[model samples]
Target: MLARLATLCPAPILQRVDRLIEPLRATCSTKVKAGSVKQEFEKQDELKRSAMRAVAALLPIPEVGKSPIMANFTSQIRSNPELAGLFKRIKKDSASAPSTDSVELS
Candidate 1:
């Protein structure tokens, strides 16, 4: 799971999670009992979830406010009215497209 998450998540997020789990990793050993191993696994899972929630909370939501990249892009688009209009048309078209929730059978 950690390997998969490492591949999927950004480096900064993974680094944060690694820091959060460093203590747990330090205590892990090959001599542990099966029950203790299970307990440790549960603890690690909990820590991972907490780290994810923390990262998620830190991220800027579009509905709340624009992130730096989004803000810059918005500014650029506003500076070019034609580009802004083109984006608006594209957005409208995408919004009006039919939903693909229902799959058509061959």
Candidate 2:
């Protein structure tokens, strides 16, 4: 829904929505930070991987035709060394893992 809205909504309204959701978005980042700390304490690779997925899902997709603001935000995430590394690992792991959604034909 958000992605659809972000894609179709006018720029002025999207800007307003972005402003309204800024605090909530920050909270998601805080949760990711907390998850990182927990992962470090518990030595949990799964936690870190899941947190990376969450961060990627919550952020706007960096595709063409998307809002400039969202594109810039995604660029910032990719530019951060820590986040870029995590995202890289996420991509690698996903590529190696077999698809869970495959269905066998009767």
For this target, which candidate reaches the highest lDDT against the unseen true structure? 2
The 10 consecutive residues of candidate 2 with the worst lDDT sum are 97-106
Per-residue CA lDDT of model 1 for 1-98, tens digit only, reads: 33334335535543354353334323321134566778776775455444333322322222212234333434454465644454444444434543
Among these predictions, the greatest TM-score belongs to 2
**Roughly what TM-score does model 2 have, to 2 decimal places?**
0.40
The lDDT values for all models are 0.38, 0.45
CA error at residue 81 for candidate 2, angstroms: 0.4
Deviation of model 1 at 104, angstroms: 33
Residue 73 Cα positional deviation in candidate 1, in Å, after optimal superposition: 0.9
Tens-place lDDT per residue, model 2, 35-102, is 46665545444444565554333343233224454455446556767556766766556555433212
How many Å off is the CA of 17 in candidate 2?
Answer: 11
